[model samples]
Target: MGRILLIGGIGAGKTSIKQMLMNEQVSYQKTQMLDFSHVFIDCPGEYLEIPRFYHVLIDASHQVSEIWALQDATKERSFYPPKFSKVFRKPVIGIITKVDLPKANIKRASSFLNYAGIEEPFYTTSVMNKDGVAPLRMRLRELNELYND
Candidate 1:
């Protein structure tokens, strides 16, 4: 399968999602640098929060087939600027994480993603409940098949 890169602000559940997808034990741990595996490229949130580190992400994007832009559903503000996804040439998928939280506002999160230049069909997920993870796995499988040939 082609590598999928995950990027977002800190505590957006990027690491947790990667762990779950890899069938590893999910735990809270801060990502200090770029992490690579056979199927995913897990980026540290600092890369997105700090402007100077943007080049790091753009450079890394070339190694992956697609990008997953994550947004914490409960966050009051977004780290991404307008049309942020346009910087990468690969396909960008929008994901709203921690949707199971009572404070999560899906509509607001969707708006943030839209402002970041992500289109329709956002995926909502909660690692605690494993909600909305299956479809992502299926999508990844489809991507693998589509690009493997």
Candidate 2:
């Protein structure tokens, strides 16, 4: 299987999503650096939050098969800038995280992703409840098949 790189703002649930997909115990923890696993590359949120660290993400993008640009559904602002995905040549998938939260706004999150240049069919997920996890997993599997074949 190919690896995926997760990028998003702080507390956007990137680590939680990685833990959920890897079937590891999901716990709240700050990512201090780049984390490499068998099927995922978990990036620190600061890489996306800081403009100078963008090169780190762009350089790291070469090692992964796909890039996931995540947006916290409850966050009012987006860490991603317009056409952010243009920096990566690989497929960039948009994901709306923490969708099960009471204050989550899927529409706004989707628009944020859209402005970032991530197209339609954005996935919504809530690691706490495992909502939308199955479909996202299936889609990842499909992408792996298509890329690795």
Candidate 3:
């Protein structure tokens, strides 16, 4: 929790989740750049979508403490490749965003994260409804404490 970076495809709720955790208003403004705060880094989804931008994240990895490889439970296509987590030395947490969506598929999200080699105990969250946000925040705090210790 030194500085958590949220990485995922667009419309996957990274900004919403960040706002939820920050207790800020949930507006629909799209993140057009690599926006980050003192505590959170909300990466643009296009970086992950475009092959050339992978290096950007890889380079940016040096600035963050951990990575949240998020997936939209409501979306269909799997975006991550197998063992993708190996590219990062930082701890990777698999997050299934938009869990409150009508079409959420938790299993499929988890499957893709697992295939990507993300660590166990993946989290499911819905920023709008505040579902599963508290526990994740608590866990981040715990991780922060551990990092400090």
Candidate 4:
């Protein structure tokens, strides 16, 4: 039950993914300072709180197992420097959301990944249709296996 941190710009569907995972019958606990194992910390996506929260990933607890960066496919790439990338330099994954919307920019998302220098695999998903979510889950499981092996 290692920590899995979900990152992205605001409205990138982090909460939606958290809610999806929470609906599963798994043990989870949340507190003011921190959220426990099998839990998701709902970090503020605003500009100021970004660095403050990401430092938690660098803890020596060996807790943060993965970093999932959610992206809004309908929008262009964020020009902000990838600060979170520096903190959670562990297994990273990209999640491109809003597949239901028109003009989804998967290529731009991939470009963003390339610009961020993230070699880890990524997936496109829509929580509404459940499209691409299963593959993401499978990829996470595969990553877990590889990490453990």
Clashing residue pairs for model 1: none
Q: lDDT score of model 2?
A: 0.92
Q: Candidate 4, residues 28-103: lDDT per residue as tens digits?
A: 3332344454545554354213655445545622466677777788878563355446555576677778887888
In candidate 3, stretches whose alpha carbon ends up further than 4 angstroms from where it belongs are none
Ranking by lDDT: 1, 2, 3, 4
- Best-matching candidate per TM-score: 1
As for model 1, its CA RMSD to the true structure in angstroms is 1.1
Candidate 2: where are CA atoms >4 Å away? 147-149
TM-score of each: 0.97, 0.95, 0.93, 0.71
Worst 10 residues of 4 by lDDT: 25-34
| Cα deviation of 70, candidate 1, in Å | 0.2
Residue-wise lDDT of candidate 2 within 79-116, one digit each (tens)? 89999999998999999999999999999999999999
The CA lDDT at 52 in model 4 is 54
> Candidate 1's error at 50, in angstroms?
0.6
State the lDDT of candidate 1 residue by residue for 1-149, as single tens digits: 48899999988999999999889999999999999988899989999999999999999999999999999999999999999999999999999999999999999999999999999899999999999999999988888898883
Task: Give lDDT per model, in order.
Answer: 0.94, 0.92, 0.85, 0.62
Cα RMSD to the true fold for all candidates:
1.1, 1.3, 1.6, 4.6
How many residue pairs clash in each candidate at the backbone level? 0, 0, 0, 0
Determine which window of 10 residues in candidate 3 has minimal summed lDDT.
Answer: 140-149
| Strongest candidate by lDDT | 1
Between 1 and 2, whose TM-score is larger?
1
